[model samples]
Target: METQLEDLRQQLDKQCLINQELQRQNKDLEQRLQEKEKLLQELQGQYHELDGPSQRPSNEPEFRKSRAAVISSEPIHETLDIAGTGVKKTVSETSLIVKAIQKNDFLSRLDDEQIAMMVDLLVAFDYSPKDEVIKEGVEGDSMYIVADGELSVTQAGRNLRTLNSGDVFGELAILYNCKRTATVKAMTNVRLWCMERQTYRTIITNKSKKKREQLMGFLKTSRTLKDLNDAQLSKIIDSMDEVKYQDKDVIVREGSEGNTFYIILKGEVLVTKNVNGHQKQIRRMGKGDHFGEQALIREVLRTATCTADGPVTCFSIDKEVFEETIPIEHLELFDDSKVLQETKAPEKSGPSSTLKFKDLLPVLYQEGRHQGDPVTLGVGGFGRVELMTTLVHGKYYAMKRVSKKHIVAKRQEEHMLFEKKILKSIQCDFIVRLHAAFKDTRYIYMVMEFCVGGEIWTKLKEVGRFDEPVAMFCTACVVEAYAYLHKKNIMYRDLKPENLMLDVRGYVKLVDFGFAKEMVRGEKTYSFVGTPEYMAPEIIKNQGHDFAVDFWSLGVLIFELLAGSPPFSSSEPQKIYAKILDGVFKYPPYLSEAAKSIISKLCRPRPGQRLGNTKNGIKDIRHHRWFSSMNWHKLRMCQLDAPTVRLIRKGPCYINFDRFPYDLAKAEEEFSGWDRNF
Candidate 1:
């Protein structure tokens, strides 16, 4: 009995040892499984990021593609009698009108004279209680300022807000053609001051034309401005403000700190200086004469006092404006020798070398080169971009492989060819460099310099919005690129974060010239192209558009960079178009006055009146107050410090880009013979 009990104890001990070993193995397996699940989740997140709509191609035909061919026409500028019959207003009424105009952002931008003229053109109107002053969806041709009583605003049966006295409504109608966005009904008997669109435009256009003509005439005969071109003079005019002084008013006091350059527009001024404890006349200046020219170059004490001889009118620009609009080097043209040297024609040079398809075909088709399979970088509706390295040269390049069948199906052959042509012809630091173009039976390929820092849109997604300085730097880069392209008569119709790439240095490089077209000055194109949110109102209307459209897109890009979204956006393209056409948008309270001003000027509904498209051209934009601190010279040379440099250096070169899966399906069909030129 003792021997059997001992055997049972030995068996129990052996069973306990086996159970302990099994528990240890099970815990080890669980840990490994948990690790695998974590890895799987991470990979799924990466896959979804790459598969998002952000990377999807946004290019689409305009919703009105089925409409009849659009006829190209010059922008209509209607001329009205500046001295037409006007309604006289009492002193109190005039003061009220001025206050009302000043309260509105759009009207407040107008000058004192313009505001006065607008007030004179306003006609008084009375509305009964509960009467509909403006109906939603009805075409509006006039704008109104509430003089008394209250009005209600509603859209789609929802009360948007209430308009009290001095409120402005339907103001966009006076600026452009658009249907009323919301209905305005009189809650109580309302008195309003209204101005028709034609009348408003006349006051704006005729006033501007007259002022420009007067300034140009004066600037042309001024000896101090002889070295400047018409465009330069125009820019100066834009920066200057009119100042009127009564007879004998002191325009500049002797020994006072001076920083304003003045040009005489009307009347005369007497220059006097205090010499030997008595005032002595130095000179008498008339129209076309200028004073305080040295004040524009540097800070100096006034050497003389200039008093108005009679009722004097002068155009005055501060030193900041003068220096920004006209560079110091350009001002050197004032020297006679420098002017002569600059006017002399330079020796003609040979044509610049461009990438040729024939020369690149040999390198691409070398036998036994041992080139590895290309890694997919990005995938889009048209095709994909792949990372490729040449074994012979050992250089990495981005090979854009566009499927031939896809282009044919979308009828985008012309656009594709044009893009290739543009890429080959341009050589700019801010633009992606295309080294070669070649073709296969299934695809057309463009080999370009690889931008390792990847797309700006990806960075924007990581950070909700950019700080002011970073946004300014990025915008300055685009401005440089646009300046070059616009000089070549090329319009980059597509301007968005997705189309802008950053290099290893974190400098922006504009890519994908699919929608770019070289239109001659004063010419317009009818074809619709561009991302929906960035599309200009003219493009949405199917009206003729030119380089001005690019400036409109630039405004959208600026807003998106600073606000994390475009001002006009919707999931439906039609809604976006409607918003753009309405020409109404609110600025966030955080936006600086300068930022809001530039965006407003750039996104003007009238293309001719746009900041960059005006007679002053891009100078108007470069000298804008928002870029007051920007060193344009440093920005153009890529010497400005980039905000993304530290972030980029810490990660892999291509960290900002998502890895896309390679398409394993065979080409649906082979395209032959048509790509002979490539």
Candidate 2:
């Protein structure tokens, strides 16, 4: 049996190597194919130019025949000329956009109505020859479609190809929220159509219902997610991220640790591996094929390297969610495996503490809201949460308005800017999505996904603590949310009930990025900015703290959820901070031993000696005896309901919040230069 197992292992290894070699060969073939296509296009253009003054196709319909079918919108007369000389021709601007959208596979998959809606969202532009449309390695959204012009695609100063009329670039970046892979410069003075990332996603979800269904279909067919029902699949699809990759881009490298699983939605990928120090191509993967299963399962090195054969589109899901979607039996098998946790061991606390907020942030500031009074959802000293509506689609959103005067006065601008950046990266379902952000002269506005069930603090206080089962469900969600945050190197400084809000479905959506800090492994901060009772000893003692601080706060949060108040609480702020430092909180006689044990371990006096701060970190907490009877898989899947989630009466249940008007305590005199980019 042993010999057979060894032989099987060797066979698997050999096949993996062969698969890699095949992928390499496939990639080479793909590159060659692209070169030949480029040459062919150049020859065709030369033939047309040299063959006499035979005019190019006059109608947008001529191009649409070979590409996608154009979808017309409601009666509107917006026209654009098909002429290359920048003269007004026959076609309408909407028709030109439809012509361009049809050329891209992802956009082409949308129905006619989606195409029409996309036409409305497009913002047209004109550029001169040699104008850099999109620069390589720069982070941006806004896909550009050439309306009438030629553009050169280059990487590392080498010309890769030329894009003519109806061609699109930056689609992948906009779709995935990733960095641009190549430079696109106008070879001829041209007209183009562009759309922002949010607009594009909105068009798909709000307008193109068919495309959303198609996305669900992709998830349904996935081998790992095949067993999930349609409802579960739909939920998963909402969290899926679309990423675009250019040709020769390494999707995953063999032996490197991975956290995300990829499913090819468009184009092809080459899967390769190394054998005896020689690179080998194994196999080629095309649309609908998924790779990196081991990655989504646990902390494991990729078995094969995958590269984009040409322009590729993929849907990705990180390990945190993947673990919940699949069967528990599957996860149990990998319990003994070695998972490499990425640790960015900085020499110090990392970035400079005193960096100016104005310098650190790229403020996407906007003006003119001369419409309606801000509908206040909740309020505090220096900031307020209000409901804002977009003029274009009329969709409502929760906008967090923070006072610039207060931030500058306290010298907390760096902390504030850092918080926004952390919110923008790598979002998942449990985390509140930062949809759009804007800054003005007086305040900064963060447009975020609105949760309907009010703060957990209100719910907990109304119910006067929770049963063990109810607290367990809420705590599990926090664990998953923090897992995503900690994986991204973000430490949530505050984890009290006030920051935990419930969605309409009762799942917790972690919010308030105000005190969150980016602390990679080996890096720490000594900032003393947290609710007094929830502050970890390290922070209170002026000792540098890291992700462990959040876990410590989690302990206090759990205790509060069960006991109706925090383990260490006092009317006086100093007394509360002192009790937190002493770490001598007691549990009531009615509290279960299991619950008390978790709080004790979590709220340990020594920050490094805390339950979750150990080598295993979150893993230890998940496997603890207190949660032994818990169905963590169900909890993560949101299959289990929070026994304590309040029944919301209104659309958002803002009634549960404090009804009195909030004061502008930070209404201190605004300073110059400081509040300009605020």
Candidate 3:
């Protein structure tokens, strides 16, 4: 009986252990089943979101850019309204502009007629993800009024800020005729309205002078020129006088005495100096540029020599003229006497006396109104001419764009800073306006006033050559712009067809300042520079010269305008140099005797013998028999009519097409690398 009882107890203990093990196993299985059910439900939700026509893109993000196209690839969907009806609206160029302007202050201020005219000029644009809207350092052609979505303003590899609807850029460059300070990139699908400089000038000129003054007042508040006023703006415009320069023409000689300033109306100029006994090129200048302001401010000798890189045009102004005409407050910015009294240099504080470009850019951009879309007219080494739009308190403006990389060489940085100085100091219609600026590590953007008619190069090429009277009239306009620049002590080095832009009314605009440099007093430069075709013999020989070189280029430009080809040329650069050294100029049979005579006087081999070599340099050129029909005083006031009327012209190149292949590739690679980082 005891053995049987012991066996039963053992069996009962084994059964109890088995029961506990089974219970634990069953609980684990139940938990796993619950987890499986949860996963299945989550997958079902994902399928519902992505399985149909409403599915979003697989690779594109929520805010990706799209091309400006007639047809869109987005998924289509039907919507049901409360009354079982649906209403839809399609996007159009006019609608896009309306949307963009409604968000901005300046464009919104325009009357219905003005707004309609602006809308008529707008073209539609769409952007893809990572598309660059504006390049840094180049003059801005257009201001973008975002219809929808977002953009980012970047500089030197840093994100400065993001811009949205109602935010306008490129106005600072347009208002000031300076280089762009930042790069703008589209962050999402963006629609923008583009306006050009020509349109804006036309609209303003059509208005009464009082209205124009009001407009000028609106532009003066920009931080870049925080101190300028309406009277000063008018004086700057009135003081403009155009002068021409040829390749290798000396603009300002080192150690020479001068009290004038210059703004580049056209072409390229090179700044060179002896560094450690070796002559080196420090910078190059292009159109809408300025130089030699130090001489204008004080009794100082020229510090550097400037020579034309090609046939160049400039607007010049003398210091005395400025003092007499410009408002006292406007003169105070560069007035040594006033600046010293208000805030002495070498001190970083006190009214922020020493101007740092970086600190001033934002204020300029913020104060100016948003202009119109950048008009597409032409492209050159300095980049594309884009139409832009601007706005102030819901009113509209027009602008142009200049690229930094296109003008400044890879090695030049300080040259760009100098260019900004020249552009910001003056305001005029003959001069391309500087509205706003932006930049990035790879490029710079200059927002400027847009001109609808395109450049003089295209016109000349289309028309072949101009008649004698027409040539004189055109030349007169160029000379006026140059007079303003030279009077300011600015040297425009390059003067070529590529740099002379024109508006609808055939008003010439000198643009590009990639090679511009500042000349302090008593400075001498000794650098070999200039394009082969238009180079002056003295510059080629490395002999020093001064502003008289501009007259030489003017002679060459006149010859070209009258005759199809430049006065001197050869098959090779070496041969061309030889011809230039020999001072060989030929007048075609078609050239008028008066025109030929003027060319001869302007192109004299000796700087002193050139038409504009004397203290009243331009006076001689103006008095030349070719200008016998012109009234100098009336011409100065733009009382004479333009020889030709310009029609809307399409840019020579397409924006969708790649102009800077290397840059585009680099930008792509950089963005891809960043994608990996993310």
* Most accurate candidate by TM-score: 1
Model 3 Cα lDDT, one tens digit per residue, 1-678? 999999999999999999999998998998998788767744664575578422434321111011111100111111211122212324564575665666553345444545565666544578876899888887665666666679999988799999876566664322223456788999988866556544443343333233334434533543433465443454344344557877778988877898777766568888888677765898887654567666555688877778898788776667765554443333532445653464333422212122222432111121113222222344443445443332332221232233444333333345555565566665555677655555554445565555555556556655556788767876877687777777566666666655666665666777765544454312223333444556665555433334555677778778776765576654334455566766756556656788878888778675544676543446667877898898867766666666755323544322212122112232111121211211
What C-alpha root-mean-square deviation, in Å, does candidate 1 show against the real structure?
Answer: 14.3
Arrange candidates by lDDT, highest first: which order?
Answer: 1, 2, 3
Better of 1 and 3 by TM-score: 1
Q: Largest lDDT belongs to which candidate? A: 1
Query: Worst 10-residue stretch by lDDT in candidate 3?
Result: 64-73
User: Model 1 over residues 62-99: C-alpha lDDT tens digits?
Assistant: 11101111111123345556586688999988888899
Candidate ordering by TM-score (highest first): 1, 2, 3
- Give Cα-based local distance difference scores for all models: 0.74, 0.66, 0.55
The C-alpha stretches of model 1 lying farther than 4 A from their native spots are 1-374, 649-651
lDDT of 2 by residue, 418-500 (tens): 76777766356677877766776677777777777777777765555678877887788889898878866678777777778
State residue 206's C-alpha deviation in candidate 2, in Å: 56
